[model samples]
Target: MIERDPLAPSRWSAEYRTGEFDEPFPWKPVLGVLGIVLVIVFAHLELQSKRIDELHTAINARLGGELEPLRGRFTARLSTLRAWLELREIDGPKMRAADLDFETIRSGGLLSVRRKRSAPGGGSSIELDSDEFGECLGVPSTSIARIQRRLAEFTPELRDEIDRTDHFLTLRGMQDQLDRRIDALLPELSLAIEARFLLLSEEDAEARELMLLLVDLESGQEKLRMRVPYEGRLLTARVMLDETTRAKSPGSIALPTELPKGASDCAAASTLREAIDGRHSIGEPMPEGGEHAAE
Candidate 1:
């Protein structure tokens, strides 16, 4: 047999060589691995960018839409409160009696009571005929209570608005100031995960404290608004008395009698000014009127 040539060309020679493999395209494995990693990283960054945009959009919706409307409602209720306080001269007993007289004639109570003036003042004139004055006094008080109830609805709405704003701004500031960069450029997935956890932990604590304070504010404002009508009706009634007498008799006691000691002492006075000073810890006497009344 002819001696086999060791390096001789054969059909199976290229396939059989095994010592040190080399390819015509030697860099393909390294390039393929790098391309796969690049694709994955770019896709992850795209998704994160989309999520950050979504967060910003969510923030705008809550701050502008919900918060603004609730604030407007609070403003409107405040205006109503001022109007209620200013309406100090609401009609008293005589005016209400006149209104009732017109209604009674229309409804035919006139047919029942004969108008008996005691033959040219033989005794002290019956001041109000008693029963009619009681009915008349309820008018201004009822009107004031109606205004109070409208204000009552604001307490909860305002609280909710404040809590919502607190939550949104806290989250928004965190995302804007801290998270945007780290989430985008970091190579390792674990680092981004750790950062997100830390940020959320801090935000949660702040939100809880803010919510509690908002609740307390809501309760306090509600109490103040409620007392206004209770005290306001009394003051309005007194002012009405002064106006009625002024209309008929000309000179009389001023609408506010000189406050004895000006409610300056802590002693009990039934009037609105005294009540406000006691409640608000204001020792200085409010001048002659309702809460906003000029001194």
Candidate 2:
């Protein structure tokens, strides 16, 4: 027999050696995936915490830095209104007392921040209501926005207040109380006046004459009272404008029909007596010149 070569390939051994079992890697790829997932989870948590802290800081800055000055302004406006009312009370007596108490008229939601997460592609924005802004500045909702325009000069400050917004909701209980007071006053004033007039005037021959005289006197008083509010409003506007910009220009509004051109010695006697009882009235055009003269 020929000597067998150890290195010679044999058909049976080659067929058997074609496939072999692979050795397992010492470090599992599954463990590497698990570690990667853990790192992602930790990073997400840290980012969320940092965002929360940023939001908290923003709120504090708005509350302490911005809202405090706004509160002071509101209080000052209320005080000014009160002073105006007091001046009128001192000057005119027929008009009922005006004690619009600010303590009772509670204000809420000065500087509240609302955050809404964005939609898929949209960015977040804030909205502010005019009524809410008015309340923040201690102005009536019916205010003609003069204050708004004036305050707009302080743009950065106003924008900050507008952005860090909060809902200003009045208490239902307080609103109900206010509603009741308004309701009681609305229908009663005219009725009370008619009743009082009837009680004062006799139902006989002198009744008509006495009623006419009383009407005349009341009309004069009404004119006087109207002047008080007009003058007070003008003065208030002037003061507010001065406070805002140190402006010294006299804001000349159109003179009404109550102020006459000439002077009269008697208290109720009108210089334009003919006009007062006739078509043309006091402070109205005296035939030719326009209502407002050139500067």
Candidate 3:
């Protein structure tokens, strides 16, 4: 081999030229691209965050301004309806008792009396006075009239049923017939009550749905909690009405197989057959031997 000159450039001189060091490292171009990508990602994220904040603000404003007021009105109406239902339940028994007392007085059975005494010789003597029999059965006419007026306040169907009951019949058959009519009417009354409740519940459901849409906006949990009591009242009223409508036994009444097509239009007929066969006490028991009559 020929001797190599130490000062001469080698075959790999092009690959390791001084120009590579004179220029900047290749990392600068990669770093610039990376910085540009980071800026784009940050800007995209900020835009999305701002849009979400704006949506939330709109939802909050609507909930506070319009939806909240509407919800309050629904709540108040539902509360009033619940109270009225409770009053009707309590008054039912009182009205029935008044009817029974009035029937007892009008029938003349309450007025029949028989007195027995030991005779001077040995045998017992019997004395019958029809007029003086139930002197104690003097239930105030005002009381009976008051009950009649209250019964009229119920739905037209129920008021019509009370009107059809024969007031001139004797006490013996009058009480039984009146009771039968009442038992038959119970189911209709229950259905009427249920119809009203269902209407109210539908309105309440709409309000609740609107509230759910606003959950992410603000006070969502608290608003939902506030609805619980109103919902409970509605459920309770429905349960009681359903129970009355489905009863199969005599004392417990039920609707006919063919129910009225329109819940609000179920009017009482001129005559109602014996729907329930068993005897049922509507209110507090009369005193022993009818000594004390209903007030």
lDDT of each: 0.29, 0.29, 0.28
Q: What is the lDDT of residue 218 in candidate 2?
A: 17
In candidate 3, what residue range of length 10 has the lowest lDDT sum? Answer: 268-277
lDDT per residue for candidate 3 within 180-260, as digits (tens), equals 544443433332222211100111333321000000011111001011111111111122333766754334434344322
User: What ranges in model 1 sit over 4 Å off?
Assistant: 1-25, 83-295
Task: Please estimate how well model 3 matches the true structure, expressed as its whole-model Cα lDDT.
Answer: 0.28
Per-residue CA lDDT of model 1 for 204-260, tens digit only, reads 122221000000111111111111111111111222235655553434334543333
Candidate 2's TM-score reads: 0.27
Model 2 C-alpha lDDT per residue in residues 71-131, reported as the tens digit of each score: 4564464343332212211112222112212221222111111112233222333121122
Q: Flag clash pairs in model 2.
A: 257-282
> Candidates ranked by lDDT, best first?
2, 1, 3
What TM-score fits each model?
0.26, 0.27, 0.26
Q: Summing lDDT over every window of 10 consecutive residues in candidate 2, give the lowest-scoring window.
A: 195-204
Instruction: Highest lDDT: give the candidate number.
Output: 2
Colliding pairs, model 3: 107-170, 107-171
Q: Which candidate would rank higher by TM-score, 2 or 3?
A: 2
True-structure RMSD for candidate 1: 26.9
